[model samples]
Target chain A: MRSLDVTKTAFSNTLRSKMRTFLTVIAIVIGGFTLTVTSGLSAGINQTVDDMLAGYGEEDQLFVMQASAMGMGEDLGPGPQPYDPEAGQQSSTFGQEMLSETDIEFIEGIDGVTNVEPIFFVSPDYLETSGGEQYTLNSLDIPADGPAMELVVGELPERDAMEITIPDTWLTMLDADAEDYEDIDPQIALGETVEIGISNLAFEQETVQAEIVGVSTANLAGIGGAPMPSYALNDELYEIQNSGLDVEQPDAFIQAVVDVDDLEANEQAIKDALQEEGLVGMTLEDLLGIIQGIIDAVAWVLYGFALIALLAASFGIVNTLLMSVQERTREIGLMKALGMSSGKVFGLFSMEAVIIGLLGSVIGLAAGLAVGFTANTLLTGGDGPLGGVGGLTLFALDPVALGLIAAVILVIAFAAGTLPAARAAKKDPIEALRYE
Target chain B: MIIRKTESIIELFMKEGVMSTPVLETENLVKVYGRGPAAFHALKGLTFEIHRGESVAIVGKSGSGKSTLMHLLALLDEPTSGVVALDGKPVTKLKPKAVSGLRNATFGFVFQQFFLNPNQTVLENVTLPLKIAGISKSERNEHGMKALEQLEMADKAKNKATDLSGGQKQRVCIARALINNPEVIFADEPTGNLDSATSETVEDILFGLHRDHGITLVVVTHDEDLAAKCQRRLIMQDGHIVEEQTGASTTTPTAARVPAAPGERPQEQPSRRRRLMKFGKGGAR
Candidate 1:
């Protein structure tokens, strides 16, 4: 018989015992649904991390600090230790291990290090628009060569300019009479000037005027949606905050951003060199590796469950086909006697199994996508649970992964069908015809 | 020895001016059911030839090897030792694919049970042989409709096989058997499951196809009246053809001798006329 006829007949035959076929397909559907959803979740998280990293900084730059700055180092073996005079030099107002000018010079001399720029720690107390209300402000320094921020309305501030970019959340704060935050437009605040107040060493507040060059969208990265100041503006603020002190101001910073040549190939070498100098260096991939590993582990565990469900579903297919073969013994004999080849008979049953797999996977794909997109909408909405984490997408479908899942299910189903199909093919026409 | 006997019979037929060619010829065919001591010899060195356009009946009681011989002749089962030739070609040596191909193209069968796929429509049932032969759908439908029309069952083509009456089902079977335009039609107790009226209708259809189309007919039955309608009858008993007769004479004047074997049934058997009278009396009820 022609292959098309065999396939058509096999599809029709699957409908003979509708309930059994439906139950088997449901088993496969469960597996496909789980696999699709989990893979989508993994893809979404990895994509979100990548987007966040792009906004963080340049790929060829590493953030380096004293090894004990972030409480990540060898065990200190208890609370207190004998204090060395050099310990005092490592201390700063920022209450962390600070890098000094000498440390920057030392890093600049490293083999792959092209340049080092100290990340000036500046805390502006409040921000006030011209003739407008004052609002508490947390600020970050924008490096001269850093990656561009995800801007919502305007461009990033020019290098070495006394300019600032505020998050969209500060738009309403910039309005003096706006009762509703939604009524304030972000574009109006783009060119406005704001005063940044910083406390000096003598307990007096110093103010500096800076232009709002842009308005950026809030995201989980970018220092928790803080306003950003250009390197020139940050330097002026830091200088003013330390004036009128009796003690000499230590030329130290919390960390330094180091540029390197060929970050992909020399990142580990640069990091190891820094480690020998009692410092730690982290690349973009290094910061995201732990998160990626966790996501991958969770995806693999879910895939294991899906595979187990598919294994059980394969047995269901075998049982269903075996029963069908038993019931159709006489029919098989009649077809064989009518000159249908054994290969055709085998093809018929295998085709039936594949049809069942196709039905299950297609339905599962539709179901998974429906749930995935719906969850994405609900969770990413302003009033939803994940709204606090800006630009978070919980599920993203991968078309290639979906196709692979369906193909795997089909292969499993065909393998499961071979036993019963072989039995049907081997039936003796005489004995089968004589069967009651 | 059996070859000589078969040659003489063929010579006799030639003398009678039948002028027909033999479509199926078997030489010393033997069939055993089991191994060694447990074996049941179904056909013991039987030799026969069925000619083209001839209606031959293999009449015997149950377990008398008539069905076995028919299966062997139809290429449905392999014989223990013998040659079953179709159109002078030894088919037993052919591969299974070739054997099924020959059966599909050249032979048709009607069984005691209708063996129709109950869920399928009558047209689908009738066109099964053509479908197995990989004929195109449009052509299969055209040929199937024509066969159904010949059986006067065109209106029932769309009806499920299970919905048909016994006589109608038998007619559908005849339609199926005729759809392939086979050279020979093998009917094994074609009317065994029908009433007298239905059986008569079925018998008429079988004989009509034989008479009108000149398709060779091989029927296996225990009914003497059915056997009487055939051109020739071979009466089997215990794995051997005990008597052979033609429609022209009730007595077996050209009876083929049974080769003698030790520890077997006697060569001398009851008269063919007496057996016919006995079966005819029983069949009248």
Candidate 2:
């Protein structure tokens, strides 16, 4: 028959058994809906993480740390930690760790090292703000005159101003009230006052107030601290305790930032540079093991549930189609008797499955989106414990993740509809004729 | 609408390229059910030819392979190495789609069980074959209504199949079979489910179609009295054609050509249902 008429006919009787159609569609919808929501959430999380990572490190950044300390009591980047037995086993991870400051110098001297900034840091004592804001202070020395200019906020801190820059997030913390602040703007404002203090060594626990000369928006949190531009981030400690012969040079900024030509291309040379400086420098990609481990755990849980729902939905489809085949037995035989080829019989039944699948998937997607969005809102909107922001918890979505989720849902719908259609197609006309 | 007659009854031989060849033909057809372990034989090499301008009856018991023969002859399944032809095409070796296509193009079928699609209207059921054959909407409507008219159920076109009476449903089944103007038609115990009175009336209508339209007809039946009304009879026993007989005459008297059962209704059975077929006079005969 004509494609239109056949489709109309197929659609017309698909719901002949109301309960069967309803149940089958429900199963399929549930399977599809869960898949969409799970995938969407995953996508959103990944997007936020991408933003978080891009602020500090570059993509494909490789970190090379000495695999084993060999009980030498030497520290890698984090601490005097032992190497993982799985270290160096994965092909995509780890470059070389035995690097030097001369290596950094050499990378800087290379043609592609367009703007290299060498950073050496010291971690200072935790300090309370003038506004009573508490923060762990880390001091970093970046090349002020050169390529690090792109990450500059308002202006580079003058060596004499004793100035230090802070991130825009610090403002959102509302140190005055210490609570009740929301990120209501697309871009945070610049220029504000922040406080720092060193204990008894500096002004009897007095807060060292600094004008926020600049704001640095590049993702500094990824590098493990609030990054400042100059070596004087803890200038008061030296002015108060060092030259007076009362203390040593003391901001205690324990880390550094070094720029190379390109992270992915010269990762080996950069690792060489950090090793020469007696510091273990690692790239964002190199430290992704914990991230990968987390990802695997989440994926397993998501896929496990998805598979269960998928199988149940598909089985429901088979049952629906089988019932349909039985119900249309006489009709099927008549079609054959009227010269309908077995192929047409197969096609009609298969088309029925496709119809069911399509309808189920569409419904499922709509349902999933509705439920997922609602859950997301409830989780993020309430005064509940889970409704947190920027403190080791993020819930958001991205376009790539949404697309992937949608594709998966559609594929699931199609798969759920196939088997029963095949069964319908393979039904015997003679037996079907005999079917009551 | 009178066709050329070589002997007042033209025989359409099953051969290639002849459009007017008998719409259905079967030879040495056998169907054995069960496998090597049980192997219950169903059809036993039954052979037959039904030509245009004839209505033939195949009489047998339930297990006599009558339905099996119907399945094979209708191209529902492949025979056990038997050749069946439709419109001179050797369809035994054709693929399933080709068989369906031939069936759609050259034949209509009616069954004792009505076989109406429960969710569809009388019009939709009757329009199905024409739709499958890619007939346009207007044409499908015309043929469908015409077929319903032939069975005296034209007024019930929009009603669901389940809503029709047992006799009315059979009439709609006949209407569905006649919608395509196929050269040949097959009926499987077309009156099996109806009351005796309804059965007699239906058989009369079916036989009337054969006389008036010159379309070939092959009917499977359990009633000897119904079988006797056809122009030819083939008695099957356990899948074998045991006997054959021809009626005294195949022609209808000029005065008796009141109306064909496929194209139009007899004045007595149906009280004034106008022929709704706009395609051709033959369909509204």
Candidate 3:
């Protein structure tokens, strides 16, 4: 028979036993739903990582840190160590790991290194705005030339200026105790001037004024700080902390940024150059890999469970088609007696399986994506459960991946139908017709 | 219009002097089941030829192998060893696909059980073979409607097969068999499941098809009364034809020359109520 007629017959026949067909389809729906959710989760996290990494710096820019002498045996990078109670109330950098001026100059001299920006650790007592509001202050140095952080309002600081960018979260930190607090609007703080007090180790305090150039959102490259300062402000703060004090020279620097000529080709050579200087050169790829690896591992485990569900669903299809064949034995004999080829008989049953699979997958995908998007909206929408971290979707469905998943399920259904279809095809017309 | 055109064409063929060949012929047919210790010989070298426009019956008791011979002649089962031909062409060596093609194009069958799919409409059941033959939907309906009209079941074409009476179901089965316009019609106990009145109605239809359309009719039955209607009878014993008897019937050459239309009602049966229905009009086409 023609394929079109075969398909029509198969479609009509699938509706013969509605309950059995529905139960088989439900099995496939469960499998499809699980796969779509897991895939969407992985896609969402990967998208966030991509956006965050690109916003922070160039792909080749490396974050260099002093190699920890204590965690030297662990080659996975300068990992965190347990904090000792006796080592309480330490500054941002230890004496041994603090970067000196000479060490920064040495890092600048390395081959294949475009330039280096030293990260200065500054301790400030308080930040006082013009409105008489004051709070504890934290800040980090901005690179002279690299990708700049995205601003929620205003513009980035000009080069060689006493300009800074404060986090939108800084106001929240100041109002932590205020009941019924609202988020700090970025528009109110744009181009605002704030006086920051810097205190040296000798308990001498000096205040300096810096204008806020922009309101920036939280980023992964912030070094765990709230505001960002330009090179000039960092220099002035460093001087104020060290002035009129018999300060000891630091042995190591906390961190630095190393720009490369061709990051992909020269990253390893530059890393070796930095390692010789007792430093750890961390690429954005390395940090992103850590997040990506964990996400992928979890997604795969979920996918494994989904695959198990799909396997069970395939067997359900097999059983359903097999039973249908058994029920239609005499009908099959009649068809053959009417001159339908074995191939046509096989096509009829396989088409039934395909239609069932297609129906299940389309419904499952639609349901999954609907539920996924709803969950994402609940978690990522303004002031929702994940209100603090704005613009982070928890589930993202990729069209290509979803399409591939559907196609694979269709093939699996077709294969599962083969055994029953073959049995039907090979049936003896004489014997089948004789069957009651 | 189609019937008139086809009749004119058949008239043209008769004028061309192409005649006297058997519609189907079987020689030394053998059918064996199982092998060795369990071997059962169903047909032992049976040979027969059915001429065009002849109504013949193969009558036997249970286990007489009459059904096996019918299956072999209809190409529904392969003969273990023998030669069967359609229109004098050797067909025993034909491949399975070729056999299926021949069956669709040249033969039709009505079984004792009717074998109508209960879920389908009478129209769907009748046109199924045409669909298998890859006929277009419009043409399948066109031909299927004509076949149903001939069987006088066109009014019930849209009704479900399960809703039909025993006689009505058999008529629908006959409609399906005639939908392909096969050269021969094979009826195996066509009235086995019907009452005496329904059996007589079915008998009239079968004889009408043979007399009207010039379709060679082959009936396999145990009923001597059913066998008596045919022009010739072959009695089977064990696995071979034991006797061949020619019944009392006028051998009119004019009846073969001018084909009879099948919608004519028999004198003994009352006229059926017209259901005011038309095939392919409201049914699934």
Query: Number of clashing residue pairs in every model?
Result: 0, 25, 4
In the range B1-285, model 1's lDDT, one tens digit per residue, is 435533533443343324365789999899999999999999987877899889999887777889899999999889999899887668888767767777887789898888999988999999999988888888999999999999999999999999999899989999999998888899988888888988888998999999998889999887776787898888887888887777734544456655533356655746655765565323421
Q: Model 2: per-residue lDDT, tens digit, B44-83?
A: 6655677756777766656667767777777777777668
CA RMSD (A), model 1: 6.2
Residues forming the 10-long window of minimal summed lDDT in candidate 1 chain B: B8-17
Q: Interface RMSD (Å) of model 1?
A: 0.8
Candidate order by decreasing TM-score? 3, 1, 2
| Per-prediction TM-score | 0.83, 0.71, 0.84
Compare candidates 1 and 3 on DockQ and give the better one.
1
Which is better, 2 or 3, measured by TM-score? Answer: 3
What is the alpha-carbon interface RMSD for each candidate?
0.8, 2.0, 0.7
Candidate 2 chain A weakest lDDT stretch, 10 residues: A143-152
Cα error, candidate 3, residue A285 (Å): 4.8
Off by over 4 Å in 2: A2-7, A50-160, A164-195, A200-207, A212-231, A235-253, A261-265, A272-301, A372-419, B1-48, B61-65, B77-83, B87-90, B136-138, B237-243, B248-285
TM-score of chain A of each: 0.82, 0.64, 0.82
